[model samples]
Target: MRHLIRRVALAAALLAPAMPALAQETLRLRMNGDVNTLDPISTTNFTVRNAAYLMFDTLYAMDETYQPQPQMAEGTEISEDGLTYTITLRDGLMFHDGSPVTAADAVASLERWGSVDGLGQTLFSKMESIEATDDRTLVIQLAEPWGLVLDALGKISSNVPVIMPAEQAATPASEAVQEPIGSGPYRLVPEEWVPGSVVVFEKFEDYVPRDEPPSMAAGGKIAHFDRVEAIYIPDTATAINALIAGEIDWIEEVPADMLRYFDGVDTAEAVAARQSGNSMQLVVNHLNPPFDDPLVRQALQLAVSQDDFLLAAYGDGEDRYLKCAAVFFCNGPYATDVNTDRVLERDPEAAQALLDEAGYDGTPVMLMHVSDIPTHDAYYAVLKPMLEEAGFTVEVQPSDWATVATRRASKEPVADGGWNVFFTGWGFVDQSNPMTNVYVSGACDDAWFGWACSDELQQLREDFAVAETEEERMALAEEMQRLTHDLVSYVPLGQAFPSVGIATDLEGYIESPVPFFWNLQRVE
Candidate 1:
C-alpha cells in the first residue's frame, strides 16, 4: 500500500498534458483520505467538506482571525428587533455551469439545507423563513434574535454549503451525489475518479469570484490556484517519504511520531498548524454501571495522567497541546488556558479514594478505541496502566474506525455487555463555539458519552444562543464548561495539533484550524 501511494504521489507531481500550463500554477496536494464525492450535503466528514469548500461558496465565511466575513452576500443588515436580516448579493456571480447566482439560488440552497435529511439541516432549522426580493437580495426572518447567525454561516460546514443548481436538486439524492455541481473555483470531472486512485478537479475558467469579500476575509486576492488535485495516499509513512522525495508537494495529517524524520529535508517544509478541531478524550457511558456514578467518572479523570499521554504521544513538544480552551485548539471563539500544573499532575491515590468511596472495588472496565487513529492507540497504551494502578480492571478493544462510529451511533452498549469507558474524538464545524460541540446535549445526536440529557445544561446552551453580548455568552459558556467538568461525563483530553509537511517553495499557504487544501496558493 505504501509503495502504491508513493507511485500516485509521483504521478501527481508531473504536470498532466490535459491541463494547460498557462492556465496558472496548479498545486497538487496529496492527502491521506479519499476525495470520493463532491456532494457537501451527503456527509459532514472533514475530508469531504474540505473539498467542497474549494468547489463551493457560502453566504458567510471566516477570516484568518476566525471572525465572520461575507462571501456570496454583499452585506447583511439586521433590523433593530434582530428578527429580520436583509442580505444583498454580490453582482454577476455565476456557478460553474455558468448560471447567474441569484437570491433565488441562495434561497434554494438554504431551503435544501432546511431539509431534515440535509447534512446541515440542524443549523438552518432555527430559521423562520427565507424570502427572495430580487436576483441579488435575500431576506431571512428568524424566529428570535440570533447574534451568531453570521458566525454560524461562516462555519466550514455551513459557509461552504454546496449551492446545487435547482434543476439538479430536483433529482433524487442518490443521483445528486454522483452528479454534484457548484459555484466555485473548480468543477468535478467524474472521469478522473479511477477506482482506488486519483480524483481530479478541473479549473472552471468562467467561474465567478465573489465581488464582496467573504465575511472572514479582511482583503486579499480570491482563490489563486487555477486547478487543484486531491490524490489519495492512505499510508502516512509513504506520504512522508513522498514529500522528502519531492514526489508530492504537500501532505496533510502528518503522523506525530514521524515529524522528526523530515526535520531538515530540503524539499519538505514542516508547517505546523494548531490542531484541526480533532480532539481525543475518554468518554464514560453514564447509562452503564460504574460510570453511572459521577464520582466514578471523576476518579477516572484523576487517575489518567495527561502529561504521560502527551509525552508518550507527542514526545515533549509545546506544539502537541493547543493553547485554546476549546476541545479543538485553533478555531473556538474563547481563549483557553491550559491548566498544565493541574492537568499534568496525576493523583492516583486520590483517584483510588474516590473510587473506593463510590463503591467501585476493582471493577473491570472496557477501554475502546478506533484502530485507524494511531494517536488513540498511543493514548490508551499509556492510560491503561494508570487506570489499572487505581484498582480498575482495564480491557482494551481496538476496531476499525467505521465500526467504532457505527457502534457510537447505535448508542448500544459495548459488546462486553456494556463499556464503562471509551476513547473517541469530537469534530466541530468551527472552534469559536466549543460549548455546542462538547457540552450541548442534543447537538451531535447525543452527548459525547451518550449521557442522559440535562435540563440545566440545555437551558444554559439556549442562554448562550440568545446572548446579546460576547461577555454574557462567554460567561454562560464558562458555566457550561464547569458543569461538564464537574459532572465528569468525559475527561477533557488535550486537543490534536495538525502537522503539515509542505514544499518550502510554496507560498501563501496559511494554516487554518480546519486544514483545507484550497487555503494554499503558490506564490512563485
Candidate 2:
C-alpha cells in the first residue's frame, strides 16, 4: 500500500514541469536536524560532523583503501626510536579570513581537540609534547611508541580532527567556538546563518584543492557549486516531495522502503552513499537504577532482537542492513562473536527469567525517542514493544535528537530529568577497533555517555592498543568482546548502509562513510 501511494505520487510529480535552475550554481541539501554548532570538538553529533566535512579540512584523511594519506602536510619524518615525528605543512593553505595556516595553529588545535576526543585522549595519554618549531614545520615527541597515531589524526567521523585558527583553537575544549574558521573548500556565510531553518556556505575562491582525484575525504576537494545550502526539513514526506519537485538537489538520508519509488524515474537516483554504514546501538545509563545492576542490563540485552530493529528501520532490503554480534564492526579485522549468543538467542522466556532473577520490580525505564528522524522513529516504535513484552515497565519519552543529546549527559536519575536509554548510530570508522570505538571505553567517570566502568575491559583495551602482532591484537579483542557481553556495556542492534537520493543530473558523488560535497557537479 505504501509503495502504491509513492508510485502514483512519483508519476504525477514527474509529469509536472521542472523548476528553473538558479542563476548561480547552488546545491540545496536536506539535513536531518538543525546544525546549532560548527565546532567539531565539542560534540559528536552526526549533523554537525556532516557539515564540518565541507567547512573544515583534516591534516590527514582515510583514502578509498582505508589507508591514511597526508592532506595538509607535505610529508612526515619519524625518528629511529619512534618518539619524534616532524611534519612539514603544504604551501598555499589559507584560512577563510585570508590568513595563512601555520604549524602553531595545528599544535593549538590538536591540544584542544586531544583534551576531549575519545581517540585523541588515548593518543595524548602517551604523548610527551607537541610543538611548532617553524612556520611550516611542527614536531611531536612521544613518551612511547603508538600504533594509531595516524588513525587518530585521520579519523573520518565525529569529533573529527579539523584544523582551525590558533586563537580559536586556544578556546577551552569545554566550550564551543563562537565562529568557525577553516581552510576548507567552503566558507560559512555568517550573515545567512540560521540555526534551525537553514545554513549557507559559499565556495572559497582562494582555496586550493589537492591535485589528486577525490577519494573518500582525501585528495582533491573541488567545490563545483558556488553556494551550498543545508536546509532543515523535519518531515520526511515533505522533504521527498521537495526533492522530486526539483526544490532540493539532495536528500541526505533516503528511507530504504522509498528507494523503489525512484526505480524508473529519470530526475533522481538512489545511491548507497555510505558503503560501510553505521552501527545502530541502544545505550543505557550505567549510573541510573535498574541499569545500575548488571543483571538488569543483561536482561535488557537478552530482550533485544537485531532483526526486528533492522527490519523496522530499514525495511526488507538485505543490502540495506546486517545483523552481526561483533562489538567492533563485523567486516573489520578483530571482529568476534564470542559470548554473543546472548544477543542472538532473543528468547523472551529467558529474558523474563533474568529480569526476575535481577529483582526488577517494574521500574519504569525511560526510553528516549526521536520523531524527527524517520529511521530512529522506526527503531523506537519496535523497541518500546520489545521492552514491554520482556517484563519491563517502559515509559516512552518523546523528544527531538537535540534534547536527547543534552539530556543524556546528565548523571541524575530519570525522575530528575535524566534519561535511562536512547538509540544512536556510529559509523564503521568509529567502531572499527577498540581504540577508535568510543562507546566501548570503560573509563568510568571519564567514559563516553553511558559511563560503564570495568577495569578488566580497560586493561584489555590497553593491551590491545600496544599489541605487537595482529594475532595478539585479535586475541585481546576477542577477550574484550567477551567481557563486553558480560558487562552489557551497550547493545549493538545492527549495522545499516543508508541510501541517499540525488538529482539524476548531479554527478561526481564520492561514496564514503561520510558524504562529501566538494567534487559534486551539476549537469545541464
Scored by lDDT, the top model is 2
Q: lDDT by residue for model 1 over 1-524, one digit each (tens)? A: 55765566656434333654652366666654566556655443455666676667677777776677777777899999998989998766788777888888777776665452322344465578888898888888888776667765655542245566766555443233676777776777666654235666766777656544332232222566666767666556776787777556777666678888686677787766653545656776777667777788778777887667667777766665642334324445554443333233578888889888999866567766544455666777888899889777777776544344335434455564455665655444443464336444433343443554567766777666667787997777666666656665567576666577887667656545555554455554
Alpha carbon lDDT of each predicted model: 0.62, 0.84
What is the TM-score (0 to 1) of candidate 2? 0.93
lDDT of 1 at 221: 26
RMSD of every candidate to native, in Å, equals: 5.2, 4.3
Provide the global lDDT of candidate 2 against the true structure.
0.84
Error of 1 at 215 (Å): 9.1
